[model samples]
Target: MTPYDAPLPQAPAAPALIDGFGRQVTYLRVSVTDRCDLRCVYCMAEHMTFLPKREVLTLEELDRIASAFVTLGVRKLRITGGEPLVRKGVMGLFENLSRHLRSGALDELTLTTNGTRLAEFAADLARLGVRRVNVSLDTLKPDLFRQLTRGGDLAKVIAGIDAAQGAGLSVKINAVALKDDNAAELPDLIAWAHGRGLEATLIEAMPLGEIEYDRTDQFLSLKAVRSHLESFWTLTETDHRTGGPARYVRVEETGGRLGFITPLTHNFCEACNRVRLTCTGTLHSCLGRDDASDLRAVIRAGADDAALKNAIRRAVDAKPKGHDFQIARAAAPAVSRHMSTTGG
Candidate 1:
C-alpha cells in the first residue's frame, strides 16, 4: 500500500465528567503496596503493622481499575507504593499498562519509588515505557541518612539514582525538609542534584502521623527554604508543567532546575486535580484528610464498570475545596495516619 493510502488513527476518548471544583480528574495515583523498606520518622515508626499482602490490590485488579479510570478521564497514571519497586511483578504490571498507552487509552505512565530497589529495576522499568521516576532522598549525608531512615543504606539509594540516570529516564529527587534533621542539607541536596543534571525538589514536612513534634516547629515552609537558598544562589521561576505538584525555578549560576512543593505554607487545594488510590483499594480524595471511599468492597461485590466509574466520580465530587488543618486545629483538630501508609 502507498503511504498516502494509510488509515488515520483514532483519537483517545475524553473523561466522563468534570467535578464541581473544576478538576477534570485526569490524573490517578495508584498505590500498589503499603510495604516500604525504610522507616522514616515522619512517615512511620521503626516497628509498625503493614497491610497483609492479600488485602492489597492484585495486578489484574489494578490494571482493570486503571483501565476503567482511563475510560472515565484519567489520561495520566502514577504507580506509587510505600515503595513500589519493592513489590513483585511490578515490571509485568508496567508491561500490561503500556499496552493501554499504545492503544491511546492512556497518555502518560509514571512511578514513585524510594530508590532503595530502583537500581535493580531501573533498566527494566525504562524498557517497559516508564519514562518518569520520583526518588525520595532526604539527606545527602550518609550518617544523617542512616539516622533518618532508621537502618537504610545510603549507598544503595545512591546506586539506584545512578542506575535510573543511566536508563535515560527523567528523574526527580524528592526531599522532605524537616527542621532539626536534614533541613540544613537542602542547599547541598539541590547543588548535588544540579551537578548530576537531575531536578531536585524540596517539600515541607507535613503533619500526618502520630508524631510528637509540633507542626510549627517541624514545618519548614518552601518560602523560607527558598529565602535560605537565595544567599547561595539566585532563583528564577520556570514554566509550570502538567500532572505534578512542584513549582519549578532555575538556579542562576548553576543552570539547573529546582522545585518546591509548599503544601503546608501555601495550599494548592484550589487547583488540585488529582486523586489517590491506596494499596488496600481505598480511594482517598485528599491526602491531608481522612475522607476515603472503599473501592475494594464495592469491586469485590461485583460492581460493574459503570458502577465503579460513578463511585470514583462521586468521590471526586466530594473532594474538599481545601484542607482545614489550620482551621480544624483552631477548633478540635485531629491527626490522620502516617504518611507512609498514606503514600508520600
Candidate 2:
C-alpha cells in the first residue's frame, strides 16, 4: 500500500482495531451532541426530538471514551455535531481533549462545524489545539442559503468563516450538491472559496433522513460536476489530506484547491480507516449501514477502561468491509439515519 494508505502499527500493549478486510482503524469521528440550532431541510425534521441533557454523555464520560480509543490505536479525533459548539460547556470539552492532543497521545484534533457559532469559538478552538476546520455551506446567495437552512443567516456564516481564517485555522468549505438546486452554483461557490484562499468541496446528497424530498431528484454526481469545471480550469491532483473521503485537487489560476466527495460514484470503504462515535455513545461501524455498538451502555454499567477498549475493538472487528449502497434499492434500504447524528 502507498504510504498515504498504509496500515499503521498498533501501540504497545494496545489492541489493534482491525476490520475483517484488514483495514486498520486509526481515525475516529465523534459527535459531541445531537443538538443543532438550524433545521437543514435535508438533514432532519425541523421540529425534532432532541436527547435529554442527562441522556447525553457527560464531559468526563466523553473524555474517558476518547482516552480509551486513543489507547486502542485511534490516532485522529474529529469533533462533529448537530453543531458541537451549541453544547453547553463545549469549550471546556475542547480544553479537556486538548490535553491528550498536546501530550502526544492523540496525533491530531479537528472539527466539522455548521459555522453559525464559529465566530464565537474560533479563537478558543485555535488556542486549544484545533488546527483545522470544515464549514458546511450549501450556497453563496443569501436568499438561497436562508431557504436551504430554513432561517440561517448567510452573513453570520460568512463572518464565522472569516473569523476561523483570522484565528490561523486551516479552513475548508463543504457544499452539498443538490440536483437542479445548488448544482448550478458549485463552480461559483468554489470560486468564492478560492478567492479567499480556502478550498471548497462538493458533496453528493446522500439518502439519509426522511426530509420530504426525493433523493433521486436531489442527488447530484460529483463526477459530472468535476467534468463541468474541467471545461475551463486545468485540474491537478494534490496530496493534501482531510482524513476523510474527499479527493482534493489543485485548480490552476485559482488561489486555492477544489474537492469532490463522490461517496456514491466512488466508494472508499476498501481503504476506510475510520469509525464514528455518537454523542449518545453508539459506535457506528459504517455510516451507510446500521451496524452499531452501544458504548454508552457499557460505560453506564461501570466498565473500566480495559472493558471500554475491548468494546471498541469488538466494534472495529464488526466493521463492514464496504457499504452495500451500490446494491439495488429493493435489496438495500436507504440509510435512514441523518447526517447530523451519524457525524457525516
- Candidate achieving the largest lDDT: 2
TM-score of every prediction relative to native: 0.92, 0.93
lDDT, candidate 1, at 297: 81
Candidate 2 lDDT over residue span 97-137, tens digit each: 89888779788888889899999999999999999899999
The numbered model that scores best in TM-score is 2
Model 2 alpha-carbon drift over 4 Å, by segment: 1-13, 326-333
How many Å off is the CA of 147 in candidate 2? 0.5
Residue pairs in candidate 1 whose N, alpha carbon or C atoms collide under 3 angstroms: 15-73
Q: lDDT of each prediction vs. the true structure? A: 0.81, 0.84
Residue-level lDDT tens digits of model 1 in 1-344: 89888987866654564767776777889988888889887677678788887898898888878887888878899999888878888788899999978887788899988899889999988887788799999988889899888889999999999999999988889999887888787888888888898888888777676654455655666788888899778899888665777888999888888888887678877777788888888888777788888888879899998798888888888887776555223233334666667666
Candidate 1 residue-wise lDDT at 314: 84
